[model samples]
Target chain A: LAKTTQPISMDSYEGQEVNITCSHNNIATNDYITWYQQFPSQGPRFIIQGYKTKVTNEVASLFIPADRKSSTLSLPRVSLSDTAVYYCLVGDPYNNNDMRFGAGTRLTVKP
Target chain B: SAVISQKPSRDICQRGTSLTIQCQVDSQVTMMFWYRQQPGQSLTLIATANQGSEATYESGFVIDKFPISRPNLTFSTLTVSNMSPEDSSIYLCSVEGTDYGYTFGSGTRLTVV
Candidate 1:
């Protein structure tokens, strides 16, 4: 399993753009980067996933650098409801069982 | 995506007692995962349940403490035995979806008093 490092917390205001970056220096060639969002008292939901380059969705955009060691999740026009914990996970297609979720980055959206 | 249904959404149990959580998926899945999330914390993988075989548990988790059973492709159960206050957390079940993602259950909030 690839170890990921991310900020413990982040703060943003409504309508502002929030970008959360994650680092996984030991990412394998077959590993994919995925992001999940978790609201209070709920399970984590898939936001976006990418193998490399950039992938955009209605929820968020994932930006993977050329080095593939780091990725960023961009949430445009944030809202108070977006306040939650965000997790960056390195997933292996062949070995998904070993994936782990670390202490996610708590995003606090203020009015 | 696979829709998961878990029973006994929340419960308050005695420290010496045990609680069983049931997860039923809408579709047949080969592997189902069990997870534990402490208050204000991230999720920890407890075990992986596959049909026709014993579950593969993660480190720090044991078969006796957290017994898992996968009767078929769509249903699984997790029983937490000899509970303690530390076991007072949310227990969740998940299955990998065909969308290259995972679908998770709403989770069982267990409060061991």
Candidate 2:
């Protein structure tokens, strides 16, 4: 399992683009960077995942560098509803046992 | 993606009592994961429930404290034994979807008094 490091909290205004960066210096060859969003009292929802380069989805986008040591999750046009905790995890997709979460970055989308 | 339905959405129990949380999935999955989330904290994987064998627990969690039962591929149960104030948290069940992404339940909030 790879350990991830991210900011403890971030503040952004509505309609702005928010980018949360995560560092996983010890990422393994088979590791993939995944991001999740969690609202109060709700389970975390999958946002985006990427191995390298960039991957985009209907909800968010993930960008990974060549080193695969770090990744970023970009949320476009933030809203108050998007204010939640974002978790960055790195693990082998095939191994469910290694799905561990790090201290997530709490993004506060203020009006 | 698989849809999960967890029962007892929220419960208030006395210390030393037990509460069982049930997880039912719409589809058959090879494995289901149980997680615990403390207040303002990230999730902690408690155990992996397999169809026909014992669950594999993570460090700091024990079967005696959190007994799990996986009778089939679509359903499982987690019993929090002898609850304490610390046991009050959100317990969620998750399964890996066909895309290898996790689909989580709404979670059961347990409040021990």
Highest lDDT model number: 2
lDDT of 1 by residue, A1-111 (tens): 438999999999999999999999998888998888999888888788899999998888999999999999999999999999999889785675445897789999999
Instruction: Give a tens-digit lDDT track for model 2, residues A36-103.
Output: 89999999988887889999988888999999999999999999999999999888887653678899
Write the residue-wise lDDT of candidate 2 on B4-102 in tens digits: 999989999999999999999999999899999999999999999999999999999999999999999999999999999989999999998768478
Residue B51 displacement in candidate 2 (angstroms): 1.2
Regions of model 1 farther than 4 Å from truth: none
> To one decimal place, how large is model 1's interface RMSD in Å?
0.9
Q: Native-vs-model 1 lDDT?
A: 0.91
lDDT (10s digit) by residue, model 1, range B1-113:
98999988999999999999999999999999999999998999999898999999988999999999999999999999999998999999989877866888999999999
Task: Quote the lDDT for B12 in model 2.
Answer: 99
Q: Candidate 2 chain B: minimum summed lDDT over ten consecutive residues — where? A: B94-103
